[model samples]
Target chain A: MTHPKTRAPRVARIAGLVLVLLTAVSGCSSPQKWDLTNITGIMPQLKFTLTDQDGKTLQASDLRGKIPVLYFGYTNCPDICPTTLATLAQALRKLGAEANAVRILFVSVDPARDTTAVLKSYVQAFGPQFIGLRGDQKELRYLTKRYRVTYGLGKADAHGNYEVSHSSAVFVFDRKGDVRLLGRGTDPAKSYTHDLKQLINDN
Target chain B: MQRIHWQKHVSISGTHGRGSMMLALLLSCAVANAAPVPSVVITQARVRLLPGNLPLAGYFTLTNDGSAPVTLTGAISGSFKQIMMHRSFESDGMSKMAPVAKLTIQPRKSVHFRPGSYHLMLMGRQQSLSVGDTVPIQLQFKNSGALTVEFKVVPVGAQ
Candidate 1:
């Protein structure tokens, strides 16, 4: 019943309203600003199949929907390993309930010494939510090479005392299982908490 | 006894604000006179208790107030079967631990054995240890004789 010219302005106004609403919604869903170094496209092969602390096989795809904070160390490492785990625990504690959505994977480079039982006790000493993983030498070599992690076994003494040198960086992946950030072992817990919260807030 | 005397002297001097300069001189003199043999004071000594039979890490601050430099050659602990000086470092993203032969501290200087630096690797626990337990350790120095101290066992993740 309305004239064509009158209907044109009404439809155009409605279309404009819909467009404005869409823009606002999209803006709200946009990714948050991350202080960590962005390595989205440069991420290496993140897929893996390893033995978890429970002696069951787990695939990397199983952790797809959760953000993963990965650290490569051995259970026998006295200083840096424990220090990094402690820092991660403190950061997760600061995140409170949101930490439940995050997964901490501690990959042991010394599979020969760190059995599933040893890994479980070692990782659980830091936090109950921490999961320990260990793979055979071949599997570890593939994953470590893909992640650019370097590790070497120290010379054993006459008494069979030895050490394993491994990487200390904490690599972080987003909810979509994409590598997002590289956190250093020396970073403050506040920085880690901020970065994790930002990742949790992002889609 | 000596700390109390030093505090009393400082407080009495503080009552007379103009005597602050004399207080400084007296404090230096007190320090010089208090220098006993093996004048190495160990503070904040703590050992991280690892799970199972894993080696533990020890950290502390050592202050030398003697007239000459001192070298910490080794350490011994009753709770651990073997104790050795080790330095932990991160180079090119790889964490490395190497045995340290000795740590030399100059006179009137302090050396801090922290998490990422010089530490004592206490290997092979003789018995189970938990948080709040104290382990007796002795530090053998080249010049300052041996100093025995108690290292409190801390959580594995303690800094």
Candidate 2:
């Protein structure tokens, strides 16, 4: 027969296990505060048509139900654009299975060079799920103008090498195509994932 | 090539037997400091072609080490009909791609070749390239001349 005093430790162990299990189900550890949800002031309504990597036409409205993470840049950008997109890739990986719930779109303002094939291979290099889109400059104008994203071609320097400067902001759209958050420069993967998760939870 | 003068302070006329060894030591030290290789060495060069209407893009990095200023005044490769240095920029809701004739680097500075920015445009590919693969790129430098660097292929969502 076990002594009643010995039974006390067993009861305590059970209680601790139950507390941890309950806490996990109750979502206590993941104190997600989505920092970028206040996005009304940044981006506006955006809708346009563009060619995918396979040269097939795809529309923004066609991506209605899923969350969209969009940014504008050209294929020739040397620094900020690439790094920013690369940083997003890190954040996506950190999202793990939740990454499937999101879509990443790289819309090119330099429509002349960022053809369907250019975007296809470019985005394909990043991940199987990544998508690149480009259209005529006129179409780009319509789309970017709505988003309030700033972009322009710089003047030629002494070497005749013209530069293209564009906005570096990454816009997050909720499942309903409404702007939800805006991410700025150079944040760690954990911060991005936390923000993304919080955004998902809120939606 | 300038060979190092390794003669020790010992007088050649009345020096001990160790004079020759001492000269060798001095020469080695001097040679070590001259033209030290950059910390970011571009080896096994590979440049990827850009698809679409735009030219191809190449990925590479500059390592810095010694004190010499290294400048890459564009590059030329044989993988396509033409290979030139290009940079992308955006402004006023417009983005543009143009050729870059030169890229200069000070001592210990690093330059990265990434998407949506400075990249090599491989035009009119002679053959198709596959993902998860790399191609040889002969990097022509204004200072170090030409050195080959290999680029690791990754997906668009690659980190």
Against the hidden reference, what TM-scores do the models get?
A: 0.83, 0.59
DockQ score, prediction 2: 0.20
In model 1, the runs with Cα more than 4 Å from the true position are: A1-32, B1-36
Q: Candidate 2: list runs displaced more than 4 Å.
A: A1-38, A45-62, A75-86, A110-139, A153-165, A184-191, B1-40, B43-56, B59-70, B86-124, B131-134, B141-144, B150-159
How many angstroms is residue B55 displaced in model 2 relative to the true structure, after the best TM-score fit? 3.7
lDDT of 2 by residue, B33-128 (tens): 543332346532334433343344576666544477777866554555667787765444344566788888788777777555667766556556
Clashing pairs in 1: none
Candidate 1 lDDT tens digits, A1-203: 76998999999999999999999999989866666666777876368889999999988899877888888999888888888889889989999999987889999998989999999889889887699999998888888888888988888887687899988778999877788898778788888899999888876
Instruction: Report the error of model 1 at residue A57, Å.
Output: 0.3
Task: Give the total clashing residue pairs for model 1.
Answer: 0
The candidate scoring highest on TM-score is: 1
Give me the displacement of residue A100 in model 1, in angstroms: 0.7
- CA lDDT, every model vs. true structure: 0.84, 0.66
What docking grade applies to model 2? incorrect
| Model 2 C-alpha lDDT per residue in residues A1-203, reported as the tens digit of each score | 87999899999999999999998988976654565546754566556788887888888787777678888887765445665676777888888888877788899877776777678767875665578988887777888778777777777656443556677677888777778777753455566677777666666
